[model samples]
Target chain A: MTLERAVAPAQRAVDILGGDVSESALKGYLEGLPGVDAVGLEQRAAGLGTRSIKTSSKAWALDRIIELIDLTTLEGADTPGKVRSLVAKALVPDASDLTTPRVAAVCVYGDMVPHAVEALGAAHGDPDQGLVSVAAVATAFPSGRASRAVKLADTRDAVAAGADEIDMVIDRGAFLSGRWGQVFDEIVAVKDACRKADGGYAHLKVILETGELNTYDNVRRASVLAILAGGDFIKTSTGKVSPAATLPVTLLMLETVRDWHRWTGEKIGVKPAGGIRTSKDAIKYLVTVAETLGEEWLVPHLFRYGASSLLNDVLLQRQKLTTGRYSGPSYVTID
Target chain B: MTRLTVPKTYKLYLGGKFPRSESGRTYEVATPAGEFLANASLASRKDARDAVVAARGATGGWAGATAYNRGQVLYRVAEVLEGRHAQFVDEIVAQEGVSRAAATAQVDEAIDRWVWYAGWCDKYAQVAGNANPVAGPYFNISAPEPTGVVAVIAPQDSSLLGLVSAVAPALVTGNTVVVVASERFPLSAISLGEVLATSDVPGGVVNVLTGSPAEIAPWLASHQDVDALDLVGAGELDWPALEQAAAESVTRVSWPEQGPDAATPSIERIRAFTETKTVWHTKSLL
Candidate 1:
């Protein structure tokens, strides 16, 4: 309860929620936000998915998607070798064609950040500056079940390891059980932990793990809380759970971000990590973003796709466009 | 009240699921007498690409199965086909404008062809493989392994029999297939797809595409993942160009001139899609 009051920045949201920054106050604020129009939200997402992007526009979307991708490899089996290769792919997504733009970042487990950083070499930095950033999944990632001290340490260690961005999964148990204060404070602390030796903080992406959150309303609330808690981006999943990053959920998150932008005059990014495997699927996300957040959020720093296999599919599509013939997996590197 | 005579929508079978063409284009398949049959998916190059992906994905499991297991799985397909015998017979009669007796004969032959290929699954390796004669202190043996995904363009004239003949042999050797059904007569081929889906044949092991061979064939020929191309059905299309495309990928090409008596099941068809793998086993620990 004290942690909820301790967060000074979320006071921006506190004013709208109630007179105070109490746990009950924020809970009421979230619960009071209009319940999701389930059918309408879904219909809008599906309608956006049907937009026909082709020819030059398709070529453009494919290249833009490559730039917006957070090329990720998160597994128990992930080795330094795997991180290096992932970084290499992020640097040069298609070896066959040098014209292919690099991905925004290479996402890895916090421990593998150094390898990604080393592999990226001089090319590592802000994606907006034409360099691929290294994003580390921290704070007991894929499941935020660790203590507060360990979670903060994980984030700081990743920043120390040269991660330019931290992808943190929120404690769903706290968020689901209505301990809104604890969830909000943890995100604030994780955001604080992103500070580097130079005092500049790494970008923080808070994963809601919407598949476990159980409802569109919860996803919207979590997205709003993450944004108010100083998350630079509100991500949809850790890519560990089933039903991750479906169109409707992403649409809901995008709407929250859109609404936040409308109220605060600041844009919060949304990254839909899992199940977005094909170039076609990624393009649908692009269409949704363009329609919701306008053309500017389409940039690498403002928007991103957290994916591993999606790059290869984009490469295959690129090859198809270039050669006027369908390319196969043999043409692209195996993830 | 009159009962509705519902027609089955013929879609392309890709990775064991029936999907309309990615191009969203369907061509009207007419009977030999010019009567209109159902619209068949005019599978574009994209659908062929998808089919190859499915076929390639199925290769590891299908090829690694014991020869006896493959035979049993294929025989299960025949069992399913036997149950749906009347459907294939009716479609064949309608599409080919053939006599009910002739259509029934064709359907029966198609089922028998599957059984024959199924039986050969356990025996083809024995007939095709050999004990290598190499000068070494080792037992050198040559075994036949499925070449990988085989792209077969079914004969346009004899839809069901030709498709069964071309595809079954490739499958018996554990090679997954992406067979293009006859553009003009695709009914029986799709019914066969239903049989495979209901049987033990794994999804992606046999992707049946119904479209223009000329449009879909070149993509499969040049696809690096496709290990072999059987163009026996490519007699009507510009087949030599397909062979040229297949040559670029180093994919083995099989374009034997099929006779007018319809496709005769051949051991060579099976041989055409199997790679000879030689292994040197140490005679004893030195």
Candidate 2:
């Protein structure tokens, strides 16, 4: 177990950014990423949403949506019982149907990681084993308002507790104030903190909290900056913000990821977590993903939904497709 | 110059707001003589489901209100119905193709019957519930509670009066209703929705869907969230099948076995949508 094998990916990030890594250089590069045509980008995303994916395609999309969900419960009232039930749901989303696909991960607060991990049990380790992975939101989530030491410690403790992925929030204060190097350094530091004792690194998802980032241009720049800092995923919001995950913002992030893949041949994940509640809305996101990044990004590793209630809606739709009857809230679990 | 007519676009009244059918389907409404009138929204099964959702949302506010407060709201509905008297008469005339006198009689009876039922909102609980003398050393009492969201298939033949008679009694008991209006004569029902909207009855407490009950009733009957199915207006359809569907979900079925109800409203209609709970209390407090 050597640090060099683990630090290879970290070294590549520095090489890709050309080794200068100064505040002004990062600012110059981020400021130079083309300005977004807000109206056109929104119109394109809207146009893509109108493409109907129905019947067998819709049925397939529902199962894929289930697999892509990071079934989340980040409420202040979240308890161990709630996290356990959330994981239970992630394992067999619809208890009525054993064939229902398990969700990609169960996302919770960092402190709740061990509980989710313990609840997952033998089904915890590998997606290939039809298991649900545990994802924890770290670095003073929702609001990234803590010191770098505390944020790193938060990341390390959750990784130590068996969290497969860490969802970290970037410092919007630094990013909005044009402190690109600080934002870049923090993500890189958090990514470094994700290293486990066995020389493995937990997946690092950087939440932009796009609702706080006023313009699409800023979202685009933050997205590219996070990728340059070696984020495995660039998440749209913390779900605590209004306008958490809109189609247009996710579309822009997907485009950034697409371009990054074209230039550097690396595919970064995109997660739109908050307001998407229905199967129809989730299908539209799938359509956007396929059209923007080719079907390659549709997998759980490259795309995910940071959601809780969205899972129930997908289950209801799945039940409708299977039974040819409509379902209600009574049909699904309360969590 | 003669004034041009501006026809009203009839939409489904769901959650107190008027929205077009989810399917965007509308059917032509004509006098029984085959003359054309306005087009009314043809509510689909999904519309019935949406109405059920709306009714479920309003159940808390309507059922939790004090009996006296519910009485006040029902009285307010009667007040609004009275203000819209001429409109109802015209709608009934157009819908049933009956003479003004006949339509007026029906409208008057509907208004009067509604008021009569409204008066019972606070009293039916007392009439349907009572204290019992038991052998144990305890005070035993029984009281009726609303059975939650009720889906009504309003009687198709007696347009205005039947609709009022069927819906008012359920409202009297503080059970929110999602009613499918008389299919052939739905203009008055949609107009009644306007009256309920302004009467403080709350939006979802009385959702009105204007469409074929045959298509909509089955969905409502089978819906798991719907507590009871009132097939009072569903006698014309394959009501036996609706009852079967309701039976599958164990929903309380309200089928008027004797056919068309009596001329006046009955307290039994209110009791049908209530569950009586009996509780025993110790004789002394510690």
Candidate 3:
């Protein structure tokens, strides 16, 4: 093989990688590139086959889809059976061959917080280890249609039951009606209630229910409104809307959180919920947070996917990579 | 004569009450002089949310106010800050750990930056914006509107100047801001916050939080409520990643060129805070 032939393959490889180059064309292009060195061309061909830019793009898209499961699973409507199944799987030990993205939290109804706590407790102590410790539909959650007093009490109850975090929904009805003050006051009361419990308190994640909010512009405004309303984290969708946790919505929230952190010297968290169900989907969100907020929020503390059942796929992928052998679904432990 | 000694602690500037960090978490503030000035709040993520609620509760009339009223309110802030010029000098000096003279210069620039932004409240739309020439004849013009809530990372070195420069533009354009001044110089930012509160600029419009940038910025960056982000003071950020995360919602990001002096600021900085929209409504013959 000649040097000119060797160089030709790399040239063809670059062309095939550009845009919509078909697979066969890419193969043909790789074969023809005049890379004079046979071993080098073969190595290059393998590298191109496995390490394409599209692979990273695909990984990112996968991450976002994985994130949707949590975004779409509304706690108020979740059955006890569903919660138990999630808890059992989350508590699975990491030492096993089963690979799982630690369930960030098992969001449940306020009435269900104790059940989740008990289930998580039975699995193990160290609240965050075996479980993420979540209480959803917080003070006026699902609907901010309650009195401030009632909502505050709701928050208090959830936190007292060992909920490490509270996912509270804002009154989008009031917000859309331009009653910003009412919406603001409701969030404040809930935040105060969270603090009164346990000396300081559980993380308060404000669910904007963006689908109801309407408009990207409104979503942006609501995001700012929720954060300023004392939300420790701002999440999209209660998983009950027609359009729950879109990529654009999560991205906007991430940007808002980033800007807020810079100006105030305070850290906030972001969770994208609804419809996520693949390893590929989870990675997109990881990439989104990684790109938007830096590497700091890559962990469960600041970044989480409100998911269910997506772990199996994530595990399967991790397993495949480690052993270089595809395994049966049962071989990977989801629970 | 005993030498005057400086105190070494920062209290939470909440509702005019200067309380110790409620979380009891404290971190050191390093000055340009290569010394630790004081131990300030390592505000937890919870504290940040608390501040947001405060800001949100206060945004009703703050953002809904008539432009004229809003301008007047902002102008009053500049006046109040002017009246307390000496206090700012003292705070900036201690926070930045600079000589009184240099601190005075920085303070003057910071104060002036507010005045500059204050003036923009009444006229920014006319300058950076205009009526668009449309092909189909209908009154068509695009103007800039506030993007609602904004989060800022004030500059690290110029403390007061950088903080003022980043903050003023955001608020002046009617966007409520949650600012994180340099952890190295919270006193000045807090002092500025005090002046704004007294100036009647509204409570949550400009909530100030202080802690570690590395810890807090990612949270803010990824936060869902924040509409836009200003990185003027973000020294070395991973732009690609930051933009990627922001791309999810296409959050507006401002990466303006760094101003000359650490403390000297500019009007161009406000460009990061505004957006232009041209709405077209067409009526067809029945």
In the range A1-335, model 3's lDDT, one tens digit per residue, is: 01111111122223324643443443343334332333543343333333323544554444333332332235545766666666666555234454333455667778776767677765433233433455456766676678878888888888777766678888888878766656656766677677633365567778899889766556666666666556777888777676777666777778778876786656777888776666655665666677678976765556667665566666555554454333234455443
Q: DockQ of each model against the real complex?
A: 0.56, 0.57, 0.01
lDDT of 1 by residue, A1-335 (tens): 01221223454555566557678877877888899999999999999999888699999999999999999999999999988888888888888899999989999999999888888889988788789898999999888999999999999999999888889999999999989999998888898888777666788889999999998989999998898777888899999999899989998998898898788677677899999999999999999999988889898767899998999999998998998766778889988
Off by over 4 Å in 3: A1-335, B1-9, B13-22, B30-36, B56-60, B135-137, B237-240, B256-259, B262-267, B280-286
True contacts kept of 2: 0.44
lDDT of 2 by residue, A162-212 (tens): 998889999999999988888888988998899887877888889999999
Model 1: how far residue A288 lies from native, Å:
0.5
Q: Evaluated with TM-score, which candidate comes out highest?
A: 2
Instruction: Tell me what TM-score chain A of model 1 achieves.
Output: 0.95
Q: Find the 10 residues in a row with the least total lDDT in model 3 chain A.
A: A1-10
Task: Give the best candidate by DockQ.
Answer: 2
TM-scores of all models? Answer: 0.93, 0.95, 0.45
Off by over 4 Å in 2: A1-13, B134-139, B256-264, B280-283
Which one wins by lDDT: 2 or 3? 2
